[model samples]
Target: MNRADETGLAARQGAASILTAVLKERRAFDDAFIAEAASGHLRNAEPRDRAFARAITATALRRLGTIDHILSLLIDKELPKRAGATENILRAGLAEILFLRVAAHAAVGMNVEAASRDENARHFKALVNAVLRRATREGDAILDNLDTERLDTPDWLWQSWSAAYGEETARAIVRMHYADPPLDISVKRAEERMTIAEALGATVLPSGTLRLEDAGRIEDLPGFDDGAWWVQDAAAALPAKLLGDVTGREVLDLCAAPGGKTAELAAAGAHVTALDRSRPRLDRLEQNLSRLGLEAKTVVADATAYAPGRTWDLILLDAPCSSTGTARRHPDVPHLKSPADRDKLAALQARLLAHAATLLAPGGTLVYCTCSLEPEEGVRQVEAFLAAHPAFRRQPVGVEDVAGLGEIVTGEGDLRTLPCHLAALGGLDGFYAARLTRAS
Candidate 1:
């Protein structure tokens, strides 16, 4: 086969693998990508081909609900239970033609060819071509008339977000997830923000984050190797900043794997001990710290069980959640997470919060946060924690704490950032954080 044909086949195969991992194995896209890359499925492809595969997978997953909705209109009967792979091929094709704006003829042809290569799917090649061709002709009109917010969001998630943030805000958040998020970077020194922004033609946020329209190949960017900055979302950067001046203080970062916040605390001159349960994820955090020329004592232990031998002056627990807030970047998150998972995570967060309170010194601050839009994981978690621990009191974040993100602060003084909060300047992940202090 020629180079172009080989590249197309590789991309389609990669997309199919990603879809199967997500739909059948229930794997997160990031984990699936890592698995694919480690298996040489992606490693063998050219850099451009690898990128295309990734884009196709993300696009297909992100718009899967809408694509499926359109596909159902074209199909005469329900797809067979065993036709998952064939269905994914059709989804990929529709994604390319409808969302990615690829030429319909090429998109349909490539996907049909992809289907023909599989014995199980070969029999469905005609079906794939027919459905996709009909999609190309009528999909846009169907999509235009569909209630995308309802179709794209899972019923449980839609109900939860809508009940919490209201219908209008929930719709806005769902719409924002359809587009790729911009890259936000946190610099080692605030003084260097302007210089780096100028170099990359990026915008500097009020919170000192450098925002790039598109940060392709982050390692290739200037100052990346020099340890001048690190990639962090504007919303993700807030929890550490809420601590306010951790210099010389003993800081504990719980569940701090992939430690952007750990680097933030260490860079702020705090003596930080970053702890996580996953050794592999901690390894990545250590690599990030090394690249940034920063230091933090790393521990591979569960946050609830670790004993630091001393009470921390400041503690940041970036607890795990459904991570629906990051759907914009991950795309597969909305498909992979379920309401039951959120409930289980909320229970864990409550335990972690209670445990973290015990580790904080009298008069020291503890920040509880989650990359979740769910109240059970964020607002209610903190409220319940306060009720259970009489010694701890809400610190109430002020306008000065988040800089430009003052609008997202709740009346009760917690930070609740939504994907729609900074809509005009791209958007932010839905994050909730509450700063609490123990009475001395």
Candidate 2:
């Protein structure tokens, strides 16, 4: 076989392995990819092969519901419990043919060979070849007619979003998840936004964030090692911006692992303290800070119990939640999360928010935010906090504060960004933020 053919085969094998990890093992996609790469499963593959494997795996997970529906039509009986690997092989194969536009012949052939190599799944090799061939012929028609919005999203999540945002918005959110999300970056210096955007061939959003079409590895980009910018989602950067003019002010960033907001505060000249419960994630945060040449006092402690022994002029509690908003980037979220997970996270968020309030000095601004679409974690959480802590009151976020994202602002002046909002700008993560002021 030619070199290109060998690479394609290796990539399909890697894709099936990743699919198995995500679906059967319930591992996160990033973790699965790292494990596979570490094991040398993809070591010899070209960069294009690696990219293809990643794309196929992500597409299969994102559209898993619909892919399963199509498989059910082809297979008469329910798949056996031991057929998990076989099922994932079919999913990876079909994802390529149906979505990635991979050539049907090559897609089917490689997957069949991959199945044959696995002892437990070898019995289904013929089935894999037959189903994928049929899928290449008729899968498009079935996919075109299916209720994709319902098919693409988990039933529990879809129901919750519909109840919270109404049917129309929920459907929009599901539809957006089908497309690959764009890359957004935050420049270290606001004054150089235009120059940086031009250099990177990126578009500068009204909110002063830069958007780039997902090209390749971020480390390969210019100025990456120069500490000129860092990667932060457009919606995520808003919480720090709400703490207007942090020049020389003391700011505490709770649950700040992976430190995007802490970096924002430091870049704005705030005396920043970054706190989180996970040491591994904090290590990553420190690495990013070092790369950007910014500094923050990093503390490894639970935000709920962390007391710095001093009141802060501002506090950003970007509390941990279900993280459903990041589904666009992390497709494993829907499969890994459930309604019960949301409840547990919401309870944790409340405790963190309350403790953060204790560290806020009189008249200090506190921005409570979550990358969650759930009201119980965002709007209701803030409402409950305000009712319980009469000493704190909502400060009302204005359109001017979020750079004309007024449509996302609620009647109570909280910012609620949905995955469907800014469709023309390639959408943003579903985020909820409420700014409050402590009574002097």
Choose the strongest candidate by TM-score: 2
Deviation (Å) of 375 in candidate 1: 0.2
lDDT per prediction? 0.88, 0.89
TM-score of each: 0.97, 0.98
Candidate 2, backbone clash total: 0
Model 2 stretches astray by more than 4 angstroms: none
Model 1 misplacement above 4 A: 37-43, 82-84
User: What's the TM for model 2?
Assistant: 0.98
